[model samples]
Target chain A: MKRLVQALRNVERHYLLLLAPLLVFVVAIAIYPLLFSVSISFFKYRLTDPTQTKTFLGLANYITAFQDEQVRKALANTLVFVFGTVTTELTVGLGLALLLSAETRLMQFIRSWLLMPMAIPPLVVGLVWRSLYNVDFGVIPYYLKLLGFDLGRGPLGESATAMAAVILVDLWEWSPLLMVIFLAGLKSLPSEPYEAARVDGANRWQRFIHITLPLLQPVFLVGLLLRTMQSFKVFDIIYATTAGGPGTTTTVLNYHIYTVGMTFFNMGYAAALANILLVVVAILSILYVMVLEQRQL
Target chain B: MHRKSSRLAFLALLMILALLATQCAAPPAQQPAAPAAPAGEEASQAPAAAEKPFAGTELVLASMTDQYVAAFQYLIPLFEEETGIKVTLDPLGYVDLYQKLTADFVGHTGNYDLMTVDIVWTGEYAANGYTLPLDDFMERDKDQLALDDIMPVSWTLGEWEGKHWAYPLAGYANVLNYRKDVFAEKGLEPPKTQEQLLEYAKMLNDPENDFYGIALLGAKGPAVAQDYMVFVQQHGSSILDENGKPAINTPKNVEILEFFGKLFDYAPPGATDYWWDQRETAFRSGKVAMMEGWSIARAGYENPEISSVVGKVDIALAPVAEGMEPKYGFGGWGIGINADSENAEAAWEFIKWLTSPEIQKEWIRHDGAPIRRSTLEDPELNQEYPWFPVLLESFEKGDGDYRPRIPEYSIIQDALGTTVNAYLVGEMTAQEALDQAQAQVEAALK
Candidate 1:
């Protein structure tokens, strides 16, 4: 007992003790459910079944997912959403960061105000934008009508514009996050390189391309990876606004999983689809890390 | 060392998304358990009357926040005052109510002692035994229930294979609400046939003046799916064949789909995105000259606060196919006791009292829909509502099975929900859309 107490008193042992609660919490709250999801993905489990039967199907659910046309279309939509939102947010966020990099009270206030969109829930944002996009009563179409643009079906009503409209809502909500991240990167950037470039007769644009862009590559990677993962899991906004419509144009993978799991109560299939999404996200994340690391080297 | 740390960072990121993935895939565990009436107060204020047998027994009722929830808000307090059974009301929107009550049942949490079941969910709930089969209680109390007073079609709200999984709570019939003033100005009459409806819609539509012929439920999911099913009912086409197997891709259904899509030409451009509320807004705001909707909403048009077309609206039985027999689409809510609830007796007491003819009069006065013949024919209510005759006629000829209240009903709704909207948005041809919907439903059944 004395030896055990002595071992427990060791500094490394104390550190383990400090982390034990959080470790337990993470395992219980995160790891268990994940493992449970993986297990269920191999079964045929209909949540509404009175008997609560679990028929083991091995790889059948995943196989079925590949065969399902809805799954393929949803996957395509998710990729489009991730690609559209991340690229636009990165470009616009970078521009906004550059413009507001100066230390001024007014700029500071505007920066705070810009974050208001992020603070509101995505579902609320989608609903407010849905009304604003209404062709008959919405302000957007009304203004467009005044400008003599014939909006045959409003932005959210047409398949051609539905995906883009949802992407714009995502952009409006998340761009401020990227701007904050880039602003931090900009602030931390070494001033010595800019000074050296200025002494070498580099103009503002030239200095930006040569010095700023190169240094901000790491920050860009961070922003891109974060948004890409979040965009893959988009649900609330889609649930609130389009509900995968304008003919499945806005139906992303996450929303499809929701329909399968919650609406249809087909738990096994839903879990399989979610695992597929996770794998896709994981592979993309790995590729992003490798590419960024190679560039840095 | 750098490779190890980078891998660790990658694993950390995986954990974050893994958490989200599980949350996304799994049924939610959290119950939105509203705070119940304080147990301490219930004990202190327990009624002394011997009649209050279930006094101090608290129950939770999950209800859809349809207009009728107002009646619940008004009546629940009175019930508590008399019976002393404290009932907490949790009002949820349509989709949320369905999903939440479903989670409660599947998890066997009994978070809700009672819930309002949509007519379409009768099959699924009964098949799963999520709700108590109420036939036994009905048999025991038939004398007091005045079983004869309930209209025959109202039984469709909860009856499955001769068992009552729920008791009919609110009954609605599909009816057409047209602007009488506009119809008079155009020298037209209310449409009695589907062909006439289309003709009158086109004639009245004037987009240059920001007015359209009709407002519709065109957004995807249940809104568009149920609206389409209403037309299927009106046209005397069944989503299922005579054998009760899904046959959504029939040539007749395809033609109906095409005709349904054509109505969009005369609706507001954004009508293709309108859900129930937006469609109601279009009519109430005087932007549409006509809207075919539930009889439940007819009364709201005369309430000037939400409606600009007060006293200008008149309702008729929804139009049927030119030569088909007139059978209005019937749908509404049924109050069911959760099978897992420990307070089933108290819950049944509440239902009996609420649906009684005496209280049902107060129910309609406070915006509740009617299930009883006496309540629908009440002289005073007739004077107040005035549209009850049309509703009575529609109910007498109502067809509730038009949407197929089967265990696989949600699957059918979901399939049609997507494809119908897909057809409306020109993503797929009518034949292709129905074929896809049929394929989807068949696959789900497997």
Candidate 2:
């Protein structure tokens, strides 16, 4: 105890040594900017005119963001996107993991190759898909025609199909993460339960459900939690593909904030919108953690 | 003893070389060492001349990535020789340029010494004092700027309360662009009036054949505004009334809205989504027979590299409305001085030389837009770039002087954009959407 106290005293003596770099970093990047943003959020900051008087209406900016139709649509779109992508990715990813676990060497090679999709930058993937979905020259329409489908070209960025298409891109890019987690979970599963089930003359399906899912519960929770967080923040691919276009059909919440904050320079309103986004993400994160904790209990 | 003396000599030589190296490297790190100057005792020192010679300084200028590179690498080398200043241009996309300039001004950093700002930013920027008033520069060198040279409207965007703040750099406005071959094939001359345009659009509508009569920009933000201006101006409907209230919901505007809505019947399938580049691409790819677009597309239309329909494109005056005057679309570019700049005089000289009629003619000759009135009408210059003279002639009928130049213009435009978008997407009836947007604009003003 005395030695520990001395060590603490020594650390305190060199506290500047410990804190100087961190203080410099945080103050430079995170802490100062956050305070600055919070300050600006109270004032109406216009990009073209900084000298323009900012209205100090408390909560008015929040009210504006909440009342905006575009904001409402974007929020709904964001929820749909997060829910749709996260759910579909987990199911398909777990299935692929189970299937791949059957074969060893071949599956290893295939697993490595399949992850190249994730390795590709989202922008390049979007560009590649844009070309493949082009009305004039895309491969999908050509193949569809070959298969006797008269479906015209230009399907990716039109109507509600665009929302589904961008979601599919997210699924393709991120589902590998789910597969990796499940693969680790499957490999770490104990053999005793399966042996006991075999001794009891239990079938593969019954044993699998009772054993595999329960055992992989922690991994599944982690994957879903991580993915739900990321899904709520999807912006770049959507921007590169459609620019929230065809009359704001595919505009998501993040893109809305970008256009509002950066494009229009409505700093106060944008900050309000950002705070709402932060709240949503925080709630989703806590819900995931609590749900998993409850299941554990 | 002799070997010891040789070692002593070697040590002495090494010490001298090290001292020389340290002294030589000190100036670069210690002072604003101008790269254009040779290494000397005076090289690292700031200029002493009160004439404000630009010879030993470096400036960063911002422009579009495409032809602006040519302007920097090719056109400015002679300027470097004449002025002794190193000009480095940072070229970016048009949208990127807007965002960057907006951010730079808002951040109060003013990192850019000069930037080619869009005309829309002028009024808003000037109102806020983000840009420098060009009065001092003009007064200092009255004869040099030849301030009366450029066209009046082009020059006016840079003005705030009778003070010139920015130089009118280049003029780029959309006119009616059509495929001559397509018009000939349909046995239809280019549409002379709004009703004729609708008829022509219907005649050329052949979606089954993978072609559409008319293509247009209907995307959100500035896209919808650009397309709507020609129509609204054609009907003599103003965005702001005499009392500074929203006048966009007037009967004239309603007729214009109805006319555009009817145009939807013959428009491309996803016409509501097409922006500037997409509309141009559609026309170039032979997918659309006609598009009401800008003079910026003129050079692209003539270039075989960018367009497949080269030599097949023609420009026309914007179609006239029945009850209103014919109006040409307003799209111009401008340059300005930073009010807080330390080297205001040098910046002024650059502006004057750049916008001079002699240079504008050279710019027009080399894949750049022209802003000068005389250059547009110059016989030889006109013959080379045929669109220049035609564009000037079209401007004669131009009572359509439209662009949201006020500080609240962006707010009004956003409301207008949403209204048009809602109406077109069947989200709201045309009248309802227009009324709502007008109400929104009214509230915004308050």
Candidate 3:
């Protein structure tokens, strides 16, 4: 027993040695910058200043962020985008996974084909959609005009429709990912539950409602968390399509942070805003972990 | 249990890193996939290899993907042959070029040895010392540069507070381009004043037939802001007060904003989102009766491949507000050496060679804008481009400071970009828009 324990300890030490490089990589790229961002949030710094001066202004940047109307509007916009994309993606993705989960050859081919959009870069997707949405010389507008829909300023050029248009683009690109995830969940679900439900005189609809959904709770949680996080960070789509235009209707939190950091070069305020976003994401992640832990129990 | 817990922690760490990457990894502006290779293989056959003082020095030029980029492509090979200095051209879009150059400057990367500086960036570049001041180079090369031959107004390309931060490379004058056939059919002359221009637009607008009165840039951000400033310049109103403070929300400017909005009534339904490219498209495709734009595009309107209205377009001086002095808008690119560049002399030599009067003619032929008075008056160029006379007149009376080339210009631009767009899209009234802009600019300045 003593010899076995010594061998196990040696194995564990080797495992730690292997993990050290990854840990160092993570610290350099992720943890260090995160800490730096948190530290800078309390200062007043402009990247464009020749002297690269930093004056301490503890909590002033955060206070200004709360009071700034642009920040508030961007936060609201981001929340709306997150909610819109996540819920719609989950529902549509669930439907697609169910319908396409059959093991037939055609079904497999169609499933692979549907995932094509996910393979293309989001920037390219946004640019292609932007052209399709153009008012004068675009296919969508031409067809919409024929169908008798009065599209004022087309879809992306109007304040009322811009956010919805952006959401639709995200849905087109990302719903396939959720579909694939839910499909894996569906495949792994035990057949015993459905068989028992049917044996108790449960119909297909009833079986799905009572057994499938209940069993898929963990998968739903995972999909929701993953998509909600991603939707909060939407930038490339808005940048390519609307550029937060038509009177700042589509500007999200990330894009606003970009404007501050990159455009204005107000690094301190941008860092504060980024930290706020990080905290929001962290809270969501913690809630996710707690729920996941309870489910395992 | 310990292994499982460690695995979970690792997964959590990965998630956070993924999120951080999204925030930090700013998408690098798309650069040309391949840098140009040096084409000077005949270095040994040169008049004298000893005379090539900067031979084998490599320079990278970051240029806006404007029409003049074609000129760069055409001229660089010849420059490489003559001076034995190899130049790699990196063409980028407008926003990308600005952001990339700023990042390079701020990081002191010394990535681009030379870059094309926009007129509006002069004050910012000078204030930050991002570019080497060219006054010394100009003085040393005064004999070769033909300093007096360059148009006086063109000096604004990179001049700030009596110092030259960049040498004038291309000069563009704002001029009116209208369909001659359409004007004749309507029996109307070119509008000579702002009021007459509006009246003509109203008369020419035929939306039912998929045609519009004029193509104007109404898109948010720099597009609309610059277009509105063009009208403000025409009205003889300044973006700055007499004391050189931002006076964008003045009563006179508010009236000008309303006038600008009114003109949009006759524009295309989708004009609200048109960028410079789209506006150019609308005019080139013959869907618009008139357009007020840079003289650089005038030649493109005659090219059959790109223009639908070839041989049917006419040029006129951009109309000014009635009773206002006729000061046209002048703006274009200036080539500047990066302050951190190690090959500053070689880069300056390239600039001298590119802007020489002899090469300026070839540059003009290949879609480059003219900065030299001699190039504008060259008999061959005059014969080739019939619109040179109007351009010369407009450049002589150009107002390069209309857009306010101050260090804080971008701040004002962003404010006006949002609010003017807000006003145009009916989210805010003209008064409220300008007022908000004023507040934003004031806050930023503080």
Candidate 4:
């Protein structure tokens, strides 16, 4: 009981010491702005209006944003991009990680090289891909033409394929980070289970299916959750590549908030839109965590 | 196993050290160098400022023009030398400048001694006394400041509800861009009227072969709103009636919108996505034979790597619509002083040298877009750069053009863009699009 008391006192001291500074910082920078924005979302406020009062209009701004077709389109685009990129990246990244785990001498160097894209600024990566996707001067078209296919013009900014192109850029830039994490987990895995499976006369494929898959579940689920969250909040790549063009086909939820609030100076509407976006992301994150946790168990 | 654990610890330590290095190097690396020199005072002459009347005072003048940064920095030395006031120039882009100034107004900070404000932002800033009156500065320094020498209209853009808020700086307009080489190759002539321009666009287009006849802004924002206003004006319709009431939908306006909507057929495939740079890029790449854009694109077109028909590119007056009047775009910017300035007198001294006829002349030579009536009308100046004189003549003759002078202009523009882009992309008929936009704007206006 005396030991327990000392342990509790130690835990309490450390908690207060760490919690005070972190809470203060969070309240000033993150929580304060978040709450302030929520309050502002209920008003009719103009950034430039000096004398006009920010008249309280409960839920009017929220209703207007919800009814906006542009907002709906942006929300739809965001969902499509997040799901499309996250699933593909997770699968491809896991596949690459497994392939990389059985590698020979250059495996470490190859692993490091694969991380180059992640190291680059997302905006620069978007710009490089923008050039690669350009119809007239891009190498993407050249290679496709070599294989007898024409991808058409201005694909990144075009209405038919802009959202897809944004997803492609995000996948290209972030898939490597997923690979690194999975590879780390794969390298650290014990060999005893696999040896036991082999002793039971299990084939390579069966061993991988029965042992490897089940063992890698924790790492795989963690990767999925991280990728999904990151993909949902993707902005710099979309902004750089498309700026949401061709009748707003590429206007993701974040981009919509930016245009409506920052560009148009509709702070109240933007705040409402941001809140909706937060709710959406929060719901997706919850689902992601639950599924990952269930899979781990 | 012990070594492996130690290696993991080493790798973790390396990452920590890398992060620490990054955090240490980040701040000074990101802070934009506060404008390197004061406006209008040449930097080399700052040492001589100690002898002048304003010896001990400090002046900070801000302007928005990275394009003319080199030329503006030249004045820092001379102005500091003659005025005995240390001057600091805060240079930024149009959008950034607006946000900063607006935020300053809200905070009532005297951060900037002389601030660069969009002349139209004058009413709110000036009326609220966030900006200082320049009348006293002008009167006291008559020998240095020359208002009569500046373009009258460009100068008046600084005035709001009958108060002088800014001095004219750089002025240019969105004009019709046509390629002389393409016209000759295609055996077509420049359009004299808006109807003819549309017809020419149809003829010049060959989209299947990777060529667009023209490029136009289809997005909503300042850009689309500005272009829509110009298009409507060219066809003889005004967004705001002379009484300053919302008046966007009329028969003539509907016809104009329909004409532009149909013209979309000849524009680039993703033309609705293009902004000023994209339009310039498309035209420069020779993907489009003609485009309606800002007048200063003559400089961009001059670049050999970009333009497919640089040597063959030529300029002509924009095609007038059915009316004889040309619907010129409100496409220029001016400068103003912040009212909360502590060193207002010293800043005014620097502003004089920056906007004076002599400095304006030098700017014309350097900046490509200087705003002064004398610079615009000089025949000798026209003889050197042929486009300058022609643009000046057009600026002199241009009339009946305006932007949304209201603070709520951005909302109206958003409504305009949503409707215009929807129509251009074939979502709705021209009449329907205009009606929807008009309705949305009117509702927002209330």
| Residue A214 alpha-carbon offset, candidate 2, angstroms | 2.2
* Residue B190 in model 4: lDDT: 81
Q: Model 4 over residues A1-297: C-alpha lDDT tens digits?
A: 454344434443454465556645655566556766887899886665555357798999989887887778888888899888988898878887887876677876787788899999998998788768755456886687679775543576456676787788888888898898888788878999988988999998998889888888888877877887777677888767766654467778898888767655667888998898788778878977787668668
lDDT of 3 by residue, A115-159 (tens): 999999999999999889988777899899999888888798888
* Per-residue alpha-carbon lDDT of candidate 1 for residues B24-85, written as tens digits (9 for 90 to 100): 66655433232222333333354536688899999999999999999999999999999899
RMSD (CA, Å), each prediction: 5.6, 11.0, 6.0, 8.2
DockQ of each: 0.38, 0.12, 0.30, 0.16
> What TM-score does model 2 achieve against the real structure?
0.85
**Candidate 4 per-residue lDDT over residues B1-446, each given as its tens digit:** 54454444444433444454444533231221122123223323345455575776876666776356666677677777776678777887666777777666555666777766554465556545566666655555566666676665676456666656666666776567888888998788888788988888999899677787877766434555567677776776777778877677777778888887777678875566566666677788788888876675676577687677767777766777866565465456556666666565566666677777776767666654667777777777777667775576557655423666565565666677666766665556778877887887776656
lDDT of each: 0.89, 0.70, 0.88, 0.69
- Give the least accurate 10-residue stretch of model 1 chain B, judged by summed lDDT: B32-41
Q: Output the number of the DockQ-best candidate.
A: 1
Docking model 4 quality class:
incorrect
Error of 2 at B180 (Å): 1.1
Q: What's the residue-level lDDT of A274 in candidate 4?
A: 87
Q: What order do you get sorting by DockQ, best first? A: 1, 3, 4, 2
**Where is model 3 more than 4 Å wrong at Cα?**
A1-17, A289-297, B1-49
Candidate 2 residues A1-297, lDDT tens each? 454334334443354466557655655566455555665667665545444456677777778878887789998888888888999999989988998876679988989887888899888888777656655446876686568755431455355476787788888888888898899889989999999999999899988888889988888888888898888887888777666754566778998888777766777778878878878888879978886788669
lDDT string for model 3 (B331-433, tens) is: 9989998887878878988999999999999999999999989999888999999899999999999889999998888888888888898888889999999
lDDT of 3 at B297: 88
